[model samples]
Target: MSRSATFDRQMLETAFSEIDAVHRSLPEATLSTLAAEVVTRVANNLRFAVQPDMVPCLDEIDMLCNALLSDDPHAATAFIENVQTKGSSYETLCLLYLTVAARRLGEWWDNDDVSFYRVTVAAGRIYAILRILRMERPIGVPDMQRAAAFASVPGENHTLGITIASDLARERGWDIDLFVGLTHDALVETLEQRQPALIGLSASGRRSMPALTRLIVALRISNPNARILVCGQIAAANLALVGLTGADAAAHDFQGAIGHMERLLDLPTGRLI
Candidate 1:
């Protein structure tokens, strides 16, 4: 997970303005201190701005969370579509409701409130819903910052989640180059050829960590500007993953993956959402 991320447009603009001022006065000074402070403040603001709105959606999200783990697959889709029909934009549906539900399932798994099997099924349902939603928009040229690649660790075979993660990112206007099943060398070769701005890799267990770390190192050398995000099981130890593997960020769900991308690239706030 990126330690510094901000979603507020005004705050970013204000911070940049301050940096511009400093540049004018002390052109020779290094900006490490200023950058750190601004990043921390802006990151804190994301929590402040989003948490209150989350309360209003909690009841609906909670209900949807349960539906996700239910036996009938249609239950989760019907519930999400019903809420969407009640006036939630597709963007809001993905960014807020589905995101909250995903996190809730994660917490349940963490606390042993739900079994891995149930949570895995529920997460799969969410991915299916995202793929269905992708058809709502016309695909277009990917913005420089919106192009990315999705892959799985070299020896790991679990890719259904990351496939849907790519779809969710697409629904949010990303151009995803999926290399989920390719071997380590082939994946690196393709990434080096395409040079996507972001890369997302899924890892299922500690066994995948060594491979994931090595891939990140290769990316750092081969595609120096490519920021890597580790998702799935490895995301449980995000900070450690970043420190140990040289990954720029980690996310457990699609929304956070996109959030990290925007923050990592410092993209403008105006979005298709």
Candidate 2:
């Protein structure tokens, strides 16, 4: 395995082990406090390797969540703006509290209704970390003819999925352009201008499907030759719907999507419009 992959796996394993250990030895309240501290420490460590601007904001999120656990409504409300400014990741942070609540309340993990607010929060933090890496640009294209652009649907907040997909594309030397949130008009304009060989859209929720479909239709009408692909939670959950919505294909996972795109583009019939 690559050094980065090995390191990531080791870190995740350590984090999970630490979480389990903390749950065993600490009181429910104490475990909640420790989780906040762990998030703060992890965020700080990540910032040391990346941007310092993220440290303060991430720390504040930890503080706000700590306050919420204690039922400090005032403190919770105070951090609302900070949370919103940070985007959907903040929602994931809020979800992290659910894990603590579950452990403290003696809730069963297998219960489908058992909330995973904490898991979501952790996922958000992961998203934030990945975003700092700017994982979308293709790394080593040999020539302009081999270049490709990548982007996501506008108003689409599920950037981590695209970021992962982009990282893989970059490693394979395909040029990528990652657009986080663009309206239908902006995306259409972009498609007309760049005329990329492949365009990938990331959607996290069903709410974004209508706009996604419209965007795909617009792209098909305006740039019928461009390859269109969709991936992420929404697409995976509704693959049939997504495929039917005019996307040439949908990838259920990041690596799968990348492989699909490469294979599709390699075909003789896959000429760019």
Candidate 3:
């Protein structure tokens, strides 16, 4: 039998409470209808739940997504507040929203229900929220002297996946360096100079495969012992393809990436609770 994950009841309650605020003004019939729609959407698509017990229900996730995507001036703030109250850590929250929440909006856009303008607006709001949250906290000091570097494969415009992983690594007291928009040559030069203990590379699609393979080859030549992990939309789906790039491993998500980092470095993993 599968073991039950340890889940904090208080965290689930807190999430529900925040969601309750949004439902307070709706009539019973309206609330029921909305809840049904939320469940349907979640069921029809892929949803990432952090823990079986603590996972936000369909209604709660739907509420949060609506708040972020809606035109209301206060909606984004409310969504952030809900996440802040329910999420265990900054990194975890970022991963959850980056994947689940963002994907939900993208699905709507694909159906022509959500416009490009609204999607960009919601993304900006999330970026601002993350900026404020990270800035409010004191800079982290590395627990171990080892350092890690993160960057996207050349030609991939989206680097947020690695950025989120970097933030989590920084929080865990790992020396983290993030580079964006770097060509393969530039990345190789930087990696050679840093010779970090670990390196993470992100690639968004199959088009990045060739450049990624070249970058990985250069990375191995520069720092033969550095633990390399490939991550991103394509990495999560096609892990075997990542191995063809000569990396040590490919992360399925931010949380899985952290676990791999701990294992590769011989460091103890942190408990989510």
Give candidate 3 regions above 4 Å deviation: 1-146, 271-273
What TM-score number comes out for model 2? 0.43
202: Cα error in model 2, Å = 1.0
lDDT of 3 by residue, 56-80 (tens): 5667667766776676646656555
Which residue window of length 10 is worst by lDDT in model 3?
1-10
lDDT of 2 by residue, 1-273 (tens): 011211133333343343334345534444344334333323332211323432344345456445443322334333433444445332133223222232332222235332344533332233222221112212232234435566676777667778877777677666688777776667777777887767787777777665665566456434545667887777667546432454667876866676667655763222244
**Cα distance off (Å), candidate 1, residue 122:** 46
Q: Against the unseen true structure, what C-alpha lDDT does each candidate score?
A: 0.61, 0.49, 0.59
Clashes of each: 1, 9, 0
Report how far off residue 205 is in candidate 3 (Å): 1.8
- lDDT string, candidate 1, 159-270, tens digits: 8888888888888787788877788778877888897877888998777765775576456545645668888877875437764455778887767877887876667544
> Model 2 off-target regions past 4 Å?
1-146, 267-273
Residue 258's lDDT within candidate 1 is 79
Flag the better candidate by lDDT, 1 or 2: 1
Q: Output the TM-score of candidate 3.
A: 0.45
Pick by TM-score: 2 or 3, better one? 3
